[model samples]
Target: MPSIWSPESDTHITAQYSQKTLDQKVRNKSALQKECGWPVEAKRAMVCLPLGMTEALGGQVFRSMLPGLFTQSMELLILGKGSKEYGTLFTELQKEHGHRIAILPASEASVHKILAASDIALFLANVESSPEVRACLSYGVIPVAPECDTLENYDPVQERGTGFLYAPAKNPEQTAWSAFAALARALETFKFPFDWKTIQRQCMESTK
Candidate 1:
């Protein structure tokens, strides 16, 4: 039987997995953004951090990187539930960044919508063979994750691989920095539409 994620499958899937044309992808993204109450605009990269929110899930590390990641050209969407303190932190950050940052409950529907609309899936926690990572790839959302057996580190020179990966660090500060650097690289690549689309396509193809 064909995998459900495969384009050949009978399952109805989002544009991210449907091998859509560029125009179709843009239209779908715009519609999803409007549905999610996000701004529908050109030249803005949508980055999503989904799943549980807690210290163990890298909530603190993500907080530390907010100043650097929340740029004018980027919009962040965070979803999940965990830790009242971390929830407050993200709520405060959302206020500070205005529409550039949004926090949403991690309902299955919301998570699926964000994954379909996002340009990048930001994973700050140390994860190996994570289902979340696979889900992002299936949705054509390029990921920035720690180096792991499950993901292939993107090779810009060769224009290959599924996503970006940084080596995990023992020190918390160093780990944050490494993750930041990897995300920075993804943001830089986002500047070039053709290259970014190539990577997105690669991500989708990987799951098949």
Candidate 2:
């Protein structure tokens, strides 16, 4: 069974996509066009990038990460100055692959809202007992972070078993790739009762 870890401070809640969100996904193409500015040819769906991660963790490694992750047609909505700083690395990366990624700038909460819209929140925080991870899980956003044994807590991605875990120190760029692969594996092979899916579902239900 996969286990998801929560902050010791409070019980985590499990949340479903809000009715307002469902309405938009179902009825508001024009709104999405204006808001997200997706190309008419591109799919409207996009992965969310959270604000805190964008701010705290979107360092040099993050700048180097985009081209690999967004090689496919994809977009981003970064919630801080971090995205702007992300430019230099992006520009360098564009020398190899250009104009295929979109970035929307805003505040952290907006990023959180976008993250909530996502299947999961991909982030890295060396800190253990993270409330951010707990909050995201409650909202149905699985967290993918590099695993650090020195951090002295169970791997959130492994323990909560809702997301992915990588050890960048060990895996380098392969770390992110591993997380994505882990996500695919989870979606395909996820089990319940004896798995993290049940735990995440219960967390969401209890939160309601």
Candidate 3:
């Protein structure tokens, strides 16, 4: 069991096991990616981890973001071995969005390599600070997680220009729509005359 840490203010939810080990893991994985010469210089918004440890967290939330993200030429890399529950859905999504989406399980080296190739790491789950978020920061990949009370202290995403924050939805059907809108907001922030590289450097520098 992995343990996920949240802000002390949100004591209502108990710590989960899987995401607790994410921070250090991100650091290590990012280092490995650098050592292996994987590049993390792209400006694409890539939503990942559904096929692996992050599966089932977002439910149907991610499905709605495909159209928007793909239109922007952003690549969504869903790594890890997907659970049986989502196998069919994943397959269908892959077929429909394979032009910009990758649905498959990969090795650690491969995972790091993929991370190195990403820019924004999207989170559709209720996670305030997931290991994937920490990992993204380590690789200079900005994190875009849901906005909620539990993450009141997580400033990176909440603060303007550092990252994007979308409100989380309670209804399962609304989850996808909320996530898509949030991601759209995030895309707007990353687009245009905005200096993405400079923002990336700033974000990396601000990380502890």
Candidate 4:
């Protein structure tokens, strides 16, 4: 089963976080390095997103804005879970882009590890019910959610300024880029990850 981030369990986590507070998370600067093997001061603009959302988010205005926002070195990790059935479009995305694209088959444990190491989570599926977003928040990770219908009802932040929501959800690529940029900004802004105490509080509040 997909990981469920119900407020029922222990609420210190969700599925995504904002990368705006990168500079402030000095203590965690070590954790990301230690846990996911990312270099300290690793400021590459990257995003880990599900593939279906990418295709769904494909619109003109958003795609045009991405190149300017992300560095050529910045990477985008596309997680399909091998079930997204978005191969044709994704192939084009990689073909059009260069080394900036890294596609992976989704495995819960491995994805969790990647999220632990990643700076931002770009969720396009309108499915942010996973508690891992909260899990990411505890680690100072942030998510950029497309303002799609499914996500409209859920609070990506679960109440604490952990993640961000990109409105209109039109341009998948540009929204992803904007999310990547937002993550960088968020990391620099909220450096401190929420602890279990806070997570539990989130869980309690969200469940209600």
Candidate 5:
């Protein structure tokens, strides 16, 4: 059985969340760190993602991002119970990057906390933006995602510095490569001349 039930292929279950609710739920940064067991002030960038088998968000594309993630020393906080296939991959990743990878099941408090503590939140598939995007913006976490035609409302990476965007391609390999490149670029933003705080403020502005 899937973690979430969906009647339609593109259904966004629990994707509706008010900014006020997000703010209230994730108000205390210290509490968020405690709940998620992530260092609120870690030097390494923390990336949180909510993905599932139903979304076709796991497999090769996901595996491709691992190398880049490990190279950057980015701590990944994954939300969603893994399907059997992803579970095996997660086990392999954990063996190599035990200190950097955390696989977490979906829980309201933990989800909000993880997003609040993350420096970036990721969405790989072309489906509608997850509600976590808004939650991440509310907490000033930049979103790293692929640009898809089906996306409605605002684009987080509309400009150069607001957030990171990768060109979505027809070929899965190309798409994965693009996403990996974007992930690398996102990690680079934390280094040198770039004003991370200003970029984060811009991410919040894009959400409006």
Candidate 6:
């Protein structure tokens, strides 16, 4: 498992996995946008879906939410392959959204870069005890995940919690709504850089 390390901290660990300082994270985000051919000046939130794009993994729910989720200030980068139907769906969405949406095959080569650049890791399905979620936290990527025992819900009053969580619902529509609401809160917080950084720091620290 990947671990988060801060330069300011005296504690040390084995250097088995990659380590990043907050400054490197900022640079990586800009470099990733450039590598993807996205205009850096646009200043949009980079929302990443790194898991496989299958209905079993919330592909259908995400499809239903895409229209409302892809606001003018947000960009979607999907980094995995799955069903042909979803491949077609995302391809069509890319056509409609142009540079705002991108799909790339998930691989070891690209996973870390995507995590480093993304403002949020979006999970539409339950991800309790998921290594990917932990990896995202290690990279200081905020997660929008289902409410589960492994994660903590962000509290605005205390300015605490590592990421955002939404209540899971039996109904697909209700689940989608809950996910959307959680993401909306994240997007709103993104507007305030200081607060967002505080959350990012908390996310990185959680893995320690």
| Reference-based TM-score, model 6 | 0.87
Clashing pairs in 6: none
Where does candidate 1 clash, by residue pair? Answer: none
> What stretches of model 2 exceed 4 Å from their correct place?
1-34, 39-45, 52-58, 87-104, 148-160, 174-177, 183-208
Minimal lDDT window, size 10, model 1: 1-10
lDDT of each: 0.74, 0.43, 0.51, 0.45, 0.59, 0.75
For candidate 5, give the lDDT of residue 124. 79
lDDT of 1 by residue, 1-208 (tens): 1122332231232553365554445554676667557778756878888665788888767767766775537887888577888888878877777567777666766666676667888887876877788777877788999888878898988998788899867776788889889988888888998888888787777776
Cα misplacement distance, residue 111 of candidate 5 (Å): 0.4
lDDT of 5 by residue, 56-130 (tens): 763667776565666676778777565787777776776667666777666765564565556777777764455
TM-score, cand. 3 vs. native: 0.63
Superposed by TM-score, candidate 5 places the C-alpha of residue 183 at a distance from the truth, in angstroms, of: 0.9
TM-score of 1: 0.86
Candidate 6 structure quality by residue, lDDT tens digits, 82-104: 78888888888878876778886
Best by lDDT: 6
TM-score, ranked from best to worst: 6, 1, 5, 3, 2, 4
lDDT tens digits by residue: candidate 2, 5-104: 2222222212224322222221222333345444542233334445434445635345445555664434443433455555554445445433333343
lDDT of candidate model 2 versus the reference: 0.43
Instruction: Check candidate 3 and list the clashing pairs.
Output: 2-17, 2-18, 3-17, 3-20, 51-80
Name the best candidate (by TM-score).
Answer: 6
Judge candidate 1 against the unseen true structure and give its global Cα lDDT, from 0 to 1: 0.74
Higher-TM-score candidate among 2 and 3? 3
Once superposed on the true structure, which residue ranges of model 1 sit more than 4 Å away at CA? 1-17, 20-23, 35-38
Quote the positional error of residue 75 for candidate 3 in Å: 1.6
| Structure candidate 2, residue pairs in collision | 1-194, 3-159, 3-160, 3-161, 4-159, 4-160, 14-203, 14-204, 147-166
Query: Tens digits of per-residue lDDT for model 3 on 1-208?
Result: 1122222222221221112222222333344334434444334455555224334677566655555556664556666465666666666777776555665456654555555545567777765545656555545555666774323222334443545567666774576666666566656655642355545555454444
Q: Write down the TM-score of every candidate.
A: 0.86, 0.54, 0.63, 0.49, 0.70, 0.87
